[model samples]
Target: MSQFDAQILVAAFELSYNDWTLGLRKSNMQVDVLLQNEVLRRGSSILEQTASSLSILPAENADIEGSNLSLRYDDGALLILGEMSYFDLEGLFVDTDSFYLTTGYRFGQWLPHITYARLNSTDDDIRRAPRIETIKNNLPAGSADQIAVATVQSLAPILWNQESTSYAIGVNYFFSPQVVGKLEAKMVTDRNGTISQFQNANTSGASAPVIPDDNRILIYGLSVDVVF
Candidate 1:
């Protein structure tokens, strides 16, 4: 048996005077796992026996909470935006703290902007997996339990334990009040020797473990938006 429940609340305010406008927004969310099946507990042998039948491992009884706040200011020609967010995932994933900021100016139908953003894991040391050799050396050689424990420990760090910073520049062209086109270029740099959400494309094979590569990535995006 498994049970889950969640609640969310949002509040926003806006004030406008002539050509200047200011706004604030806040949100909070909480999730509670009321019940969990016995078979789903960590280190349960049922998962190995029935691995093919299960597609997901549900969280045990835990509380997951998050909140965010944002402030914005926009005049007829200039705009500024900022936001901060945090999450406590209760070990379902790595807890995270993030921030974002943007500044933009409008000229006729064209709006150009610059943005800076950062995301950091608050519990990186706890989530990082121990090396396989370290785990094996401490355990009895060729023990049946050795392989099982080693595999799990080696894969733990793959669970979103990284930090990154991003810088972006973009332009939005307003075709009308309801339509817009955007072009953006962004660069993401890894921090603290951690791989920030990027997977290695050169995996050896299914039998090989996929590792995170420490490298910077550049992204280019073009898109159009239409509002009904």
Candidate 2:
């Protein structure tokens, strides 16, 4: 679901589920296209820097266009999914393209899944950090440049080119034909990568870029599904 409201002018829209499914000897394949928006909520940390001495940055809206192709084998015993998504930015630094691949296997009620994803910038100038030349051109004032620089200096989470892998183990319990509950624990590994950042030296017309740290996170979640 999505709504486009700019300057109090309101327009609403919803997406319908549409896909083409083909049945094979032992598997089913499906494909679909999606047009959506990744609406960045105001005050999101991705847009705002948390460094005590830096200024706050505003979040920008992104238009996402993507498609998904998936296959399921033996009534959900095994599954594979792949997707390619492109993000168009509004008043942000650069556009990005992403690719994702996922596979899952189910043994009785236990399901294990793994996913790989990569994000790359379309704007070559924004390899590690937003280009100062781009900033100066997009925002032509001294004040705007200062804010942009400060925003980068604050180390906001900007998705530069990076690759990550995640693994999850879960089980599904069916309460009825139309209802189910699922529990899963997932761990994600983010390798060392360079994201766009601002440096005080850059303010003085020098080059300064920041390299992000490698990290990992584990998440546990439970979810319920119901169908009418």
Candidate 3:
């Protein structure tokens, strides 16, 4: 299909007094895809291959809209931040929402922080598509076309959707004005059988990927940074 166009608007505000500072920001975005005719044609072709008498028709233009809001506050010794974001893809039949929060405290030359984040996605629109509905209703239960459609519908959400939560704790040490040492540990847990962002481990020697039974993982990291 044709390319998409996007428009965005943003606003931000900040205040600082003595050693305390606070900031807020908001943004909105819209994306439009020029694929109505192409989509209908392809959808109709798929139905024809399945020997369905139904034909797909053009619908509303494909579009996605999203918004984000965030806030941050910091004093000489304490820091806090939070953000939320959401997106609705009208044509693709997908919606996503996410949240994040972090807090940290500084003591002399050291700072320790903890963070939490969550992401969720759904494809209710895809399940409600005319082409998919036709296939589900018209095709035989064991037919190839029916099986293919069912497989795709079952795997799409697992491969492209997300429902996960993450928690992390980290500490930073200022070795000097221009150098720092950092250590961090993080844990991620998959939710609702979604694995869109996780790395799947393979043990079967087969080329195909396999999901891990344990959906939770812990990661450790250490680093040193020097700025000149």
Better of 1 and 2 by lDDT: 1
lDDT of each: 0.64, 0.44, 0.65
Please provide, for model 2 over 1-228, each residue's C-alpha lDDT reduced to its tens digit, 9 standing for 90 to 100. Answer: 223432222222323233323322211112121213222222123223432111121222322233333333334566666655554433233455666666677666555666666655665343234443343345535564445554453333343334445566666776776887888886656534534221221333433444434356567899989999
Judged by TM-score relative to the true structure, which candidate is superior, 1 or 2?
Answer: 1
For model 1, the local distance difference test gives 0.64
Candidate 1: residue 201 Cα off by (Å):
6.2
For candidate 1, write residues 8-119 as lDDT tens digits. Answer: 7677777777655556665555555433533223322322233311112223334455667677778768988888888766542467899999999999999999999999
Clashing pairs in 3: none
CA-only RMSD, every prediction = 6.6, 12.0, 6.4
Error of 2 at 5 (Å): 3.1
* RMSD to native, candidate 2: 12.0
Clashes of 3: 0
Structural similarity to truth (TM-score) of each candidate:
0.69, 0.47, 0.64
Flag regions of model 2 displaced more than 4 Å: 1-64, 74-76, 88-124, 127-145, 148-163, 193-214
Error of 1 at 167 (Å): 0.7
